[model samples]
Target: MNKSMNVFVIIALVMLSGCFPSNDLEKKQVHLTGITMGTVAYNIKYIEQPIDGGTPIPSDVVVHQNVERILKQLNQDMSNWIPDSELSKFNSHDSLSPVKISEGLRRVIAESIRLGHLSEGKLDVTIGPLINLWGFGPEARPEKAPTQEEIAQAQARTGIDNLMLEGNMLTKRIPNLYVDLSTIAKGYAVDLVAEYLDSISAHNYLVEIGGELRAKGFKHTGELWSVAIEKPVSTERAVHQIIIPKDNAIATSGDYRKYFEENGQRYSHIIDPDTGKPINHKLVSVTVIHPSSMTADGLSTAMMLMGPEKAYAFAEEHKIAAYLISKSENGFIEQFTVEFMPYLK
Candidate 1:
């Protein structure tokens, strides 16, 4: 399948699992859903009440418009597919000279670089060339696996050391060093939307972009916001677990929904930067909970690349609240960090 088409399917599957409330919910909460960042959908659920019993909360229409505007601006700055987006322009630049970037993009790129180090270079933004070669990027899927020579060439152009961010300016250590922020951009968008909601006094709300989510405060009924973790099976959509995540962000990365199988071999879109190939392991999905959705997003991808055992150990060492699901002959095996147990339902 085309990468874009697969993304739409993934978004649809994400939407199917707790992206909206059930029909029996109270009417006091405002729910809004819309498309953003190509194939992802943004869902916002917030409680509506008067301020000081005198000023009315912003109308749903106004809130939606504001959210859309914020997301549009974010896309313009970070989307690599936009051709003229800031990231796109930077990628196409062949100079080692510093290029000034928007504060938002700068923050995201800096965080991505920091995560690349934290994950032992597992989550590299400079892996774009390899990703495109593996048929999981903007380029069309190839008819066969890339040749060793092709893979070597792509790998040569990729490295976390090839990029640097100083203040609001980003510079490349090597020419034609491409950087793709797809792994972390949606999560940043989620955080950005959540920040905007807070600015408007939408304290009690849930913000989700793509599959990354953040929730704060309580619902209209005085309960914490609930979210469902989808089972890792591709054949069916089932809730693996539900959690009332209060004042924290959640992100999940999985290979089940985004991969191509050929001759009984599966190639996932989640590439391991060090290998320049999709991760081949029993680990199927990783869900991370943190205060920053961006951090959780990057960590989930890094954990997936680390596979099951190493990822579990890494989570334990870092004291991160992470949930891991792995493929087994008996079906699936689920595990969680000590810190994550309290949120499981």
Candidate 2:
């Protein structure tokens, strides 16, 4: 497969069991699946049961419609590809003054800035220019690696320090700074869907967008939600580990896919903001489990950029539940933080 197709295959590694309940007393399962945010697929499963034992459970049509509406609104607010999206408008704005933004955009930008600080600018949203120059953003892919001068030009337009968020407004320190939230937006969408499910009394549900996911309560069989982490291999897909992420969100970032090889060297899409180039490290994948899918998503990317050793230290220091997989001469090496041990099945 080509590099782009390889990315889709690897991302499909997070498998879920769609088994339905057989017993009568067991809550009925409602599954909703659809495409959203470009090529990403979303799957939402929840138990259909009356909370008060009197009101009838919402029909499948109602739930599906509501979920789609929620996703559509989120995409409108955050999608950089959409010419009319709020983010796109902000990017096009040349003013250095603070520009008013919606509450949703404000929250996303604030969280991104916080993560940038936490990761010491490793997970920067302002690196869109570099990403585009490297043929990973909305721009068309280049036939070869970018030259040093081109990379330096893109790097000049990026820096976490160029972004500022205050209340419901965002300001750019420099007019040329471009921001992209593709790394964390999907995770935030998952969390938003989970919150919507909870608000509708859906205590037992699994929310997954792309490969990022959040699970709460239990399945119809009274068992916790099971998630599988994909083994990082280009030739074939396989499960590396299975875990019961009860009432938690899980996200994984890997470099085994979405990469191109030239002159016997590989260039991954996951760029290191420090060097303005693709990460060159033994670490293949990093998974994080947290209370918020948004946090897990951002942390996973940051940890992957740190590589195996630093990622392990960061996870331990911050008390983050994380799993790191690295490429080894013989095969692959697997490592998990102490906090992640409880979830392993």
Candidate 3:
């Protein structure tokens, strides 16, 4: 899937997850570049402060090359949409044969399944049909919303329980079940890229793919990464910003993007699994910051589905920092969990 295809609605607005600025320093530097991986174009920045004649880090070519290799493998292995990809072949053949897969693919699939279970099936990978039926992807849409009977049939085939994983192999228990990793794939890929950069002993870096981002050590000037939280309306402006240090990930999920209007009603891309319809709630967007990219990605989506009040409670209970933008008759109301208040400055 082309990253461009994903409207910069929620997650993309927080791409600057890490942006540290040097304070009381004489020297300043920044490295800005872009790299294309799979179907997404990532904007990468490498900032470093020379420490008493410290040698410069590796060139941008090296970083791009490494990211390319990882992304290529991920795109090929984890993609169920591709006919010859490992997942596609497995789902197509419906065979229990143990297919060997790369470590990255294995980890991605495992984490996805775990999220599906932990979220009580709220975040499901077997929602490909739902996504397509609602015209969230490349599929055509019907002139009207899916009938109750059609939605029920799609809902029956969608669930985490339909997936069976044993060691390196995976098989679909339901014949029509198709897995779409759009919810977390980009975030996972960003983390993988960050890990590779860390492996090379490189710090002070920020990487963004389709607006999902991960930070390394610090900015070249030694300030936390500064990212903007977008207002949850149909505008291209950001109303607030958050600064985060290393070892944290942020993801946003909302319905402001990729929505269609029919009969004077708006239908968003976020599907309501229970009703097999686009979610219609008070929330416009939810941004989540966590220690893990996978957690950040999944929780953002789950909270979007859980609505405002429950999402606040859930975040508070989990000790997660969250910022939610909701729609009201007066305008947009901004709310945040207590955990995120410390970073409000």
Candidate with the greatest TM-score versus the true structure: 2
Each prediction's number of clashing residue pairs: 0, 0, 8
lDDT digits (tens) for residues 25-111 of candidate 3 = 333444544544345677666654443446565666666777778777777877755678776765566554455766766777788
lDDT of 1 by residue, 1-345 (tens): 001101111212221123223343343889999999888877888877633444567899999999899999999998877999989999998999999999999989999999999889998989999889988888999989888798889999989988998899899999999999999998999999899888777777888888899998766655567777787878876777676666899999999999898788889999887777889999998999999999999999999999998999999999999988888776777888988987766
Clashes of 1: 0
Model 3 TM-score, all chains together:
0.85
Q: List TM-score per model, in order.
A: 0.91, 0.92, 0.85
Pairs of colliding residues, candidate 3: 12-211, 18-225, 19-224, 19-225, 19-226, 20-223, 21-223, 22-221
Q: What lDDT tens digits, residue by residue, belong to model 2 across residues 199-249? A: 778877899999899998767766668888887876777777788787899
**Strongest candidate by lDDT:** 2
lDDT of 3: 0.70
State the displacement of the C-alpha of residue 153, model 3, in Å, after optimal TM-score superposition: 1.7
